[model samples]
Target: LIQTFEKNNDATIRNLEAWSLETGQQVYKINLTGAILFVQINTDNSKMLVATNDQYLRIFNLQTGHEIFKIKNQWSDAQKEVTITPDFKEVISIYKGNNLIVWDLEMGKVKATFTTDNPLACYTVSPDGKTIVAAEIFGKLHFLTLEDKE
Candidate 1:
């Protein structure tokens, strides 16, 4: 399953669409509020993570289009990037103040936080989900290895 977003007019329509490659059919669609900044599907493709301009990261069940939970930004700025771990246990978000936060999906609590000197330009989790590479606005890239908790 593949997911994509669509924009309508000036409003950022958060359309979570799942397309079938075999038949070219849209199997599922979930519309969310706020201007979406980022969207990521869990490794198992059961859930989706969406970051919007409303300073919140929301999780939704793709199969039922039901929202599972949302992580509201504690700071004044909104989240810039978000991704889910391959194990589908955690969600990582980079806030506007260069704050990197790891959230436990099931527990609904922050697992860890890292402060950076420069604002984050972008970030990507490694395919194996053991590491994360984030680029700062000053053009410096930082690599972080995630520790296994259990």
Candidate 2:
């Protein structure tokens, strides 16, 4: 499955669409109130994570075209990137100040926070969602492991 977005003349987001690459048919479409900064589809393709410039992250059900949940950015800065965990149970995001946060979808709260010394250039989560690898602009890389909190 592939997803695409359309923008208006004002450089604002107009809509988000999910398409089937093989059939070339749209599976779902949703209107947006803010410009999208990042997007990620869960490994199972059941849900989608959308991060917008309006300081919000929204998760939607792909099949029903309904919003599952929306998260307001806690920090004042805009989110630089976002990704869904492999298990489809969490949303991970990197903010402007290099703040990495993991949000538990079921709990509707932040599950963990990792501070970085420098601004994060990019980040990737392991397939099992147990580890996160973050890279900085100055050729520095940080590895973080998630442990059960009990």
Candidate 3:
């Protein structure tokens, strides 16, 4: 669950607070240097990932409040549009101005990546978790299959 403290401008006054649904205890607190672009709470509610205008991504342990991972260069677009997999095991972040990266949460590595030919319209993952498709300008689409990953 997410609770926000608002400033006079109606922007978030401070870092957002993450709480447990059952007990309502503070699980994590996330701060942003700039506007937050992407915010995700994992399926099990054990992890939360925050993406921001700072071009940084950080993963925190919901229970212990420890930072488990931090990554940059995962997304490059100042547009700051990112989507997390429903299962919370994968992340799809696109910074179309420079590149695109799809990451594996467990390994914390690039499962696949590609540079854009032109500006990107959008990106999507296959329902089975095996493929990623990105739509680009001029009605072009790129498909990357991960079913054969070793």
| Backbone Cα, N, C clashes tallied per candidate | 0, 0, 1
Clashing pairs in 2: none
How would you encode candidate 2's per-residue C-alpha lDDT over 50-89 as one tens digit per residue? 7787778788887666899898865444445677778877
What is candidate 2's CA lDDT for residue 87?
85
**17 Cα displacement, candidate 2 (Å):** 3.4
Question: Which candidate achieves the best lDDT against the true structure?
Answer: 2
**Per-residue accuracy of model 1 over 1-150 as CA lDDT, tens digit each:** 677777878856667787887889888787776677777777677887777777777888876667899877543444455677888777787755688888878887888787789988888888888888888899989898888677
Candidate 1 minimal-lDDT segment of 10 residues: 73-82
- Predicted candidate 3 versus true structure: per-residue lDDT over 20-121, tens digit per residue: 778978766666565566567787878978776667677888666578997774565456667666667777777645366777777777776778778788
How far off is residue 53 in model 1, in Å? 1.6
Question: What C-alpha lDDT does candidate 1 achieve relative to the native structure?
Answer: 0.77
Model 3 off-target regions past 4 Å? 5-14, 20-28, 96-98
Model 3: how far residue 35 lies from native, Å: 3.0
lDDT for 59 (candidate 2): 84
How well does model 3 score by local distance difference test? Answer: 0.69
Worst 10 residues of 2 by lDDT: 73-82
